[model samples]
Target chain A: MYTSIAGSVARPSEVRLQSPRPSIPPSTAQPEPVGSAFADLTVCRHSVTMSDPRAAIVPAPAAARATDVAIELLAEMGQDFAGSRSIGETLRRALHRIVDHLDAAGGALFLLEDDGRTLLCTASVGATNIEGIRVPVDRGIVGRSVRSGRGELVGDVRTDPEFFQAVDERTGFVTRSILSAPMSVRDERLGAIELVNKRGEDPHFTPEDLRILEAMAASAALAIVNARLAAALVEQERVRRELELAAEIQRSLLPTPPRAGFPVVGINVPADVVSGDFYDFFELADGRILFNLGDVAGKGMNAALLMAKTASLFRCLGKTVHRPGALLARIDAEIAETATRGMFVTMVAGILNPATGEICFANAGHEPPLLHRDNGTFQAFPADHPPLGIAEGSADTPLPEATVHLDGGTFYVVSDGVTEGLTVGGAPLGVEGLQDILREAGRLPPAERLTAVTSVLTAGPRPLHDDATVLAVVGGSAVTRPRSGSAAGRREPASEELVRVSVPSCADRLRLLRQVVALSATQSGCCQEAADELVLAVDEACQNIIRHAYHGDPTGQIELSVHHQGRDLIVLLRDYAPPVDVSRIKPRDLGDLRPGGLGTHLIRALTNRAEFLPTPPGGGTLLKLVKRIR
Target chain B: MNTGMTHRVERRQTGMVVVALEGDVDLQSSPEARRVLLDAVAHGGAVVVDLSKVGYIDSSGIASLVEALQKARQGGSRLVLAAVSDAAMRVLQLARLDRVFVIHPSLEAAITGDR
Candidate 1:
């Protein structure tokens, strides 16, 4: 009995413990009274329990005092685990504490694997020779306990059918009288713990040994659960990193709002990593543009994926040929073949010809759109077919083309989310309401109109119920007149004020002249576009001065001036030379880009009066060219 | 019409267009320069609007010029500035208009230089 309790001797001398040994004759040590409390000696510090050595021996008087001692040891180990950051190492130390503090021969800790299939033996104690040994659920006693979820004590190993003798062969030890218990947590069987043999024994494990094994298994299970949860957290972090990377790639694909050139202007906003809503414009052959605005019926990365697919499909179609209605019908068929089978899109595909200001669109079950006219009126056009993918040959329900003329007027298309968008209060800005805002802003410049849309959306600051998208196009008459300044007919200076600026060549002279003329139109102070004819006349005269007078070498400096008479701007020019010989002057020789003759005629054609005089005491000539702006 | 605070913008054809100033032209009236510049090109014979009496020209003044430049580009016209008041000049120089405009020593000089 004495040698068996220490564990080291019994593992080797498993059968030898059958000989009853009276160690320290019972009389020498006073017979201690039985325990006052039969409760297991396993103690708990802050609800953390420990192994009880005297669990099988339930004499009341003796157990109470032993329980006190076991609890004290458990409290110390609890403090150690709390301070440890390393979960695996902490569990290892915890298992070792159970073996050292309790009278167990050995113990093993098993954790549930992520796949939930295997019980991993991570930490062990009293395992001197074999530490790396893993017991599969199909292998040994440990496996059976987990499968049955019941503790098993084989009093004699040789006679027990549940005993798997291979471990003994591997460890070079003869194990006997085993006590083991299953570690269970919320219906999940983690693993089992086994104490090989009792130390002080009549060669068999007692209920006390089994009780201690159960307690140790419980502690191991808790630690394993915590570690498993931590592993799951790290996996989620990895998934998040992948999502962020994908989001960045997709965001770069969207085009920025271009400076609305001749005819068109549009805007788009994705709801998430990918948008179910998308708009695209790609140039096709012969000044024909392929364009589309589509809405996928879903959310998140899935919808974004669908949107990308839809966009690429159209791009492919555009590459082969440019047909509006037929292409949309093909796309509808394609959508049915590919993409999420049940999902669909409401799309409008078209071809735009800026030179002719014509757009042929196939509207396939999208929101009804509004076209703003140049006469300050609006027209709403609705859908004909069901959304694409839901119906085949549905585009055959031909939507009569609402061909409205576009001349410096805007057209707006929106998803239901846009018009249905409400204030923090319950006021939903519906089609008419939205039309009101657009109409009010219709008179505004194109840039301001776009800004107004942003402001309108921002009105709903937080918790937007759904995604909103606004696409606006201004067609034809994209030529916006100068609103801030007018260059009607600004003339040259009457009193002859002119600043000399170096010109590089005749080509540069025209450009520089344009620059100076533009600057004068803006800064020359009277009123913008003050005098239409005079400014045109002065510009023609200046061109004449550059072409005919200087031959446009672009090397010399050209002077500028703005002379006025009671709000009128008249221009004058002077050069250090003689007056022009009026009769000999001929028109331009276009053969090699020379000037003078044509320029003077053009000057005569544009200006009110023209004259030339000799420069004061110099070889240069002083020329006068005048026009009125105010 | 209340020409308000005048700004004598210079010209490419002539030297400067004298725009007279008579009111408290602040941020509200600053873009008026753009309006005035555009109007002057169309009507301003060849003269600079004088801003010597303008009490204050703030950041809005910079904005006004930028607006004027945009308008000129759209209309294919010329725009310039002649004389800036000392206070306005200090503000303008700080804002770098001295680097942007013709910025003559005086309005008359701007005109004479053009001649």
Candidate 2:
């Protein structure tokens, strides 16, 4: 028996000596004793009872007192784990408090590392600091407790085979008895808590001590799990923010919107934070627009990185390499040297000559480019070579280059994502669907037409599985005059003189000449379209006289006359300037994409027969242009 | 709008320059048109020439626009023709310049540079 501050009570160890199974008297069970409330909280494996009813009169029985201490210790440890932000610091403090409460020589808390095969000592309170000690999970008493998912109570370490001696030998700590309890939440085994050598007369830990330690281990396991989950969430958020910034930067590298009359336009939509598809177009110094569209084999970061590399390489080298095939070959070689195996790029590169309305292009394992003609016909040019990076410099064979005249037509180049894109019905939008969309929006401007087509695919419920991109080049309308049987083909009864006027050879007089021709042609039974053509033709003819014959001199004189003969209108202009070689007055080649030389072409295009008339007088040049009324 | 004698130059709050020509653009008036267009291009901002009120445009007028465009391109600036009249459009189409020069349907569209 021991004497407590409240009253005399049987010591916990001495009570165990009294009987194997004790019984509580009826009187003791009826009265509520002070500090005995914790008796119910203690998880008792064996039923505890008072031997005598008289002994229960005391404030607390030996077993009840021991239960109170255990409940208090567990409550304090729970508060420590819950309130502390630094779990490491809180755990170390917990181990220290537990050691003091149990009167143990030392204790250590081990946690399972990510590898799951090793136990790392994370917190310790003992003669030796084993805070960074590592041991295999199958090595010692601690490992055994964790592996078995149970608590271990060692009465004497020298006799126990599970006790590992290397740790004590290294730290110089004399370990006698040991208590190890595994930390677990449900079926998940975290690690184990180990206490060595009881400090009092009893050098071994009691079964009650093992139960208390196991309860503390459970709380620590839950706290560590929560901390790890929080860390993972924070890391995920950071990666999301980084990806958003990368997408914005990728957008900045793309070309700006072209000027209103610019011939080429493009659009790109990515399925994720970054895109594997890219397109670019820029005007070369020679007035031809160079353009390209590429698709990497995959999606996400690796593909996006390759997309950037390929796009930039095209833009940088395209400025100098004029041929589409040669440019693709160069890019292919560059990419093949560094690109990952099994990954490749499908690309279509082209150059558009706005002046001649010609497009020269090369396709490398890409979707065929569609040419929608003004006369309601369609033409497609398929790939002539394999995709880049598949075979080094795959475009070695002279690619089958195609030149198409865009006579009031449009050329469309798109990534496979456009054709393979899902529609509202969850089916792949085949080439036919894309063509239908294009025909529906054919009359719209080129940019709006592309938008209309892309919107149909993008408007579906599902996200795009691949990157979608489009590039369009709209052709100019070809000049076509009304034929003989058309609405402007009305015939007059007789030929008549339309107008006769003369003025100084000056640019200012050209407009007056245009008005004269417009009035005369209208009066001579010409339709509004034919009259407009006559006005422009005469205007251009007179301007040529002022610019070439007069040499921009305002002193020279010019005579303009318009005559109508049945279905024919003839315009005559005589400039009083020194006439020279008539054979040298030829218009420039129309293929030349330059300004100024177009005036001569414009006159010839508007008239059926434009020729230099036989030198009329002593020192003047006479030019006549004939236009059929139809 | 038929005056053929007046032109207005406006600098909007968006830092865009607008040169509005209200008349026929021909050999006689083209020199003045060229001066206004070039000066706007030299200002180092996007320039939009509104030709909605132009009744007619001759080759000389087209030449002046081409010269301004060349100068704008040399300066790394932008120049676009907006609201071109039908008569002028026909002339440009005849010259095959309708595909060369950037043409917008509205002055606002030209200034915004969306297309």
Candidate 3:
């Protein structure tokens, strides 16, 4: 028991009772050193429980006879020995009570520290400032009482060698009788409360003295024990409050639900009191949407920290990054340079068309997301590259792009926890189990369907080992698809210096303009105007290239480059061909006011700007026509 | 060319001087073009930047030539760009540098009697 003077914050008289009787009390006229003996005497304002009023209800001792009357003499002092109620005055009052009860010259209370190895005399009276005398556990008569777990009674301590003479040497007090008992409650020992010299002016302590002081030791132990329990309860409550506050802040950082216009849905769940899985969804400047999900390597507090850091880094990169493959490459390079070793994250991010339904996605060694077809079939689209934080640069791992139509079909995505869940009988709920569940649950509402499937998968003996999270998107539709056709239509400028453009928006404008712009300077009229026409034609043609030929997804370039060879506005249009057939157009059909399939008609109406050219590298369908305006 | 800092700027006539800069005329040290040409043109002279000594150049290095031309014009003087560095020439060619700045054959040929 560490009995700390965690003592009441008060002056020496109010806080501790070190000198019961002053053999050399400090002079009222003189000053004392800052700390000669009182350095270890602590004074703290502690909130201790006051003594209960009901404690006064005690049975009176049996009637004292003649020899017993002598025994009753010590009991008479018992009235003064009653313990003091806790306050700054407790130590002072308790010391006076013990001096009267034991019929002694004086008494002292020494408190131990948190560790039982050291003691500091906490309270004293009579002898002046013994304010703080340090004593070790195995040193003197007080120590002997603690070690032997009993009282010590001795007569004439000046002859006794176990008696520490340093106190007598310092205080000049006579040492004749000593009665000490270990102050303890149950198994805990605080320190010793000892009475010195007989008050009736006797020289030695009797056996009756030992019994009297032991009673006082019992009362002292109870007071110290109660204060300790109060301190511990307050500390435990403080720690619990701090943990609850920390957990609340962590919960607020999770991803918000998607907005009305986005085509994806994402979800994340942490297994413990906190989790590290995170997801974010937002839009890019070009009307394309960006969404990502990342699973951190570990769980609990460490995992949550990494999850937050990863989200912040992703947002900074995602803003400047546009293409899905290019974005992933930059992200991988950044994480590889900064991520801590042996700890990495797996992630998948993608861009989607809220209007056209085109999607580009990149995965870094994450679980292959499952795509469910409208007809109840599913395909596992696995990642072609290693996980993030493994390597840097686009060349490190060739992450491939897989495109699929998502019109009227739902895509089911999840962490590995779903596929790896097992039944009570030790069989895994593999892909087959998932497909079977999806087929049955497909008819139900999407949110409810998820709840029903997760329950069955996570039921019984071998359920999920970690937190399970699943995100499902029920959609499949695209607008404005690409088509190819062949045509033999050409337009020639009627004048001497004018160059004409035929079907300028037909994926071959750059090729046509480069040829015409080069030849325009040598022509008879308006060189800059001709060059300007060719530039505009090139712009329109590139737009057509993206909309046509490549089926609205051109991953390569169209060649419209050409050089001048004098007066001829010789324009050349080159591409790998699916040539548009101009003969199929009915001139009378334009009267019907139909909007689409007018590719050549629009090109013809926009420009006699340059000659149509045919310069396909394969030697097929290259349109080369020249016009001169003068 | 009696070169100074790996280059030379010799006044061949009253109205013109041929400043030939050598080595990589990059952003760090293209200021020699402005210092030498501006000083020569202040005396009511014209100039020609002989690029025969230059090994390379970029856009910031190009600004010195434009400043020289602007100062020569303010003095009612003329300036001509002479044979450019092959590496520097290629960057100029890509941005159609031939359209904006005049090209000459040699320092002596362009500045010889232009005053």
Could you say which candidate leads in DockQ? Answer: 2
TM-score of each: 0.45, 0.55, 0.41
Candidate 1 regions with alpha-carbon error over 4 angstroms: A1-222, A260-262, A392-402, A443-451, A454-462, A479-630, B1-115
For residues B89-113, what per-residue lDDT tens digits would candidate 3 score against the true structure?
A: 7545433445566677766567664
By TM-score, who's the top model here?
A: 2
Measure candidate 1: CA RMSD: 20.8
Query: Which parts of model 3 are misplaced by more than 4 Å?
Result: A1-240, A259-262, A285-287, A322-343, A356-359, A365-368, A373-409, A416-439, A453-465, A478-630, B1-115
Q: Which is better, 2 or 3, measured by DockQ?
A: 2
Clashes of 1: 110
Candidate 3: residue A506 Cα off by (Å): 54
TM-score of model 2 vs. true structure: 0.55
Candidate 2 per-residue C-alpha lDDT over A75-140 given as tens digits, one digit per residue, 9 for 90 to 100: 455555555667789789988878888888899999988898999999989778899999889988
Alpha-carbon deviation at A100 in model 3, angstroms: 10
lDDT of 1 by residue, A30-55 (tens): 21221101012122211122223232
Q: Output the lDDT of residue A161, model 2.
A: 82
TM-score of chain B of 2: 0.90
Error of 1 at A614 (Å): 43
